[model samples]
Target: MLIIFIICILALNPIAATENSSDWKTQKVENVNFKLAPQYENGELVNSKYYTIKNMFIFSIRYIDSDSFLKSSYGDDASSEDTHYIKNKNIKGHNSSIIYQERNIDGVKYNTTYIYFPIKDEIYCISYNGSNITQDIEEMIKNTPKQTMSEKKFYSKLTHATVSYEYSQREENSYNDYYYRTPYQYNNQNKNQWGKYYLAYSLGRSSRYYY
Candidate 1:
C-alpha cells in the first residue's frame, strides 16, 4: 500500500512543481561576456570597463581598506546593508544580484543587495553548474557567483524576462545579471523530487569575507 501511494505521488509530481512567477526567463543581458576580471589577474585596481557582449558595465575594484567592503564573494560582513536587510537575523544566502529582504549596515537599515553588477544602467552576474561537486559557490569557488540551477535559465528553454540594476565593488565592472532559459521537466511523480536538491542547495550557503 505504501509503495502504491508513493508511486501515485511520483506520478503526480509534475502537478506539485512549485513554479515561481519570477523563476526562469527567456530574456538575457546582451553584448558582454564576463571574464572573472580578477584583481590578482590584473594586479589590483582592475578598473571598470564596459563590454559589448552584454552591454553591461563591470568593474574590479579593490577593498576600501578603511571600510570592510568587497571582502570575498560571500565573506563580507561589514556592510551595514547586510544587517539592515536581514535585521538581526542570519544571512540565508547571497550572490551577484539575489539580495534578501532587509539587513543592517553601519547601524542603518538597508537591503541585502545581491552580487548582480551594474552596467551603463544595467545589472549582471554569472552562474554555472549546481549539481556537480557542490551546490553554491563560496569564496572557495572561482571569484564568481555560483548560483544553483534554481537561479539560472538556459537560452533554449526560456520565454522572456527583464533586468533591472547591475552593481559591483570593482572598478572595471561590466556585466551583472543574465536572463536565459533552460530545460524544465514536469513530473507529478516527483513532488519532493528536487526537495533534497533544494535543501542541500539552501544549506550550501556562500561564505563571507572581510577586508
Candidate 2:
C-alpha cells in the first residue's frame, strides 16, 4: 500500500507541473494581440516589447513604419555569413518571413530565430534567442490577431540612443584588436549589435558603425 501511494503521487506531480507551466495568458500591444506563458519577464522600449522566458529564451515585437517594414521584411543587407533564411511561407494564414542566425560567443554557439510580417502600415517582428522554443514562438506569432495600427506615427529617437549606448558598452568589453579584425570577427565581437541596428535602422537612421 505504501509503494502504490508513492507511485500515485509521483505520477500526479508531473501532470500538475505541466498544467502550471503551460498556463498561457493573452497580451496586447497597440492593436496586436498575442499569447505568452504566465511565467515570463517582459518589458517595453520605445516601439518594442520584449519578453524573456526561462532566463534563456528572449522574444520581442517591434512596430515599424512602411519604409522600415520593406527594408527589414527580407532581413538586413550587412548581415553576417552566419545568418541565413530558413523559410518564407504562410503560417496560420499569415505570410511570414523567417530567418536563422548562429554566432560563436566565447567558444559557445548561440542560435536565434526571427519572423517578420506586415499589418497595415506597421510591420511586426517576432524574434527568439535560445534553443528548443521555436515551436512555441511560432505558435505565439501565428496566434497573434492581425490588426491595423492607427495612423499616428510611432518612431522614437530614444530607441536609437539606447542602442548606441549599449553598442558602446559592448565595444568596451570586446577584445582590443576588434576594430582591426575581419568582418566576421567584428560580427562575432557583438552578436547583439545586429538587433541593435535593426532597431536603429527601423527608426530611419543608419548607424555609422555596423557589423
Candidate 3:
C-alpha cells in the first residue's frame, strides 16, 4: 500500500507541472517582448506581463512611448510617507531611474521598486513588489534584451494594442486593490493628487497587471 501511494504521488507531479507550464505564453507589447501568464482583475485581462516568485513577490514589466513617459507622473505620493527617486542608476549596462516607495495599508507595510530605462523611442519599466531584490529578479533584468521592430519581426507579434499611459490610484478603503485613471481624469479632476501608492497597490495585489 505504501509503494502504491508513492507511485500515485509521482504520477500526479508531472500533471501539476504541465498545468503550470501551460499557463505562460509569449507576449509582446509595442516594441518589448516577454513571457507572461494571463492575469485577471475583476474578471478582465490586464495589459502587462507578470511572474510570481515563491508566492511572495511579483515581478512585472511594461513599456510606453516617450511621449507618454514624459507626460505621466512618477513621484509625489500623498498616501505614502516615504518615497524616493534615484536617477541615472546603471542596471545591466542601461542607465535607469529607480523609484523606491513604501506604503502602509491596513497595518501592513509594502515596499515596491520601479526601474525605468529608455530603449529607442519607448521607455521600458520593470517593477517588483517586495522588500528584498533576489538574484533571480536581477537575472531577469540583466537578461532583458532590447527588442525592436526590425529584429525578429517574423517570429514576434504584438499581442495587445497600446493604450494611452496613465498613473494608477489606490481605491478608498481597500487593501491591495487599485484602479487606473487616465491622463484626462487627472487633468480635469485631481491633477495634483497623482501618487505612487496606486502603483504600489496595483503591483502588491495578488497577480494583478498594470501598464
Most lDDT-accurate candidate:
2
Error of 3 at 196 (Å): 43
| Number of the candidate with higher TM-score, 1 or 2 | 2
Q: Which 10 consecutive positions of candidate 1 have the poorest summed lDDT?
A: 156-165
Query: 1-211, model 2: which lDDT tens digit per residue?
Result: 9999999998877444334434566666556666764433354433324333422225566554445343433334114476754555565655555667777767977687766654554566666675333555556665666534432222222234335555555666675566568888777757778777887798777675554
Kindly indicate the candidate among 1 and 2 with the higher lDDT: 2
Clash counts for all predictions: 80, 0, 0
TM-score of 1: 0.20
Best by TM-score: 2
Q: What are the lDDT figures for the candidates, one per model?
A: 0.29, 0.54, 0.46
- CA lDDT for candidate 1: 0.29
lDDT of 1 by residue, 1-211 (tens): 9999999888776432122212312121253323332221222222342222211111222212111122333223223243233211111232223323254446854332233333222334322212121222222123223334232331111111211111233322422211222223234324455565566567784322110
* Residue runs of model 1 more than 4 Å from their true location after superposition: 6-8, 11-25, 31-78, 81-211
Residues 1-211, model 3: lDDT tens digits: 9999999998877444235533445455455544443341112124443323322114556564434343342323212347654444555555565666776667876677766555543556666676454444444445456533232321121101112221332323233333456667547554333334466576685323332
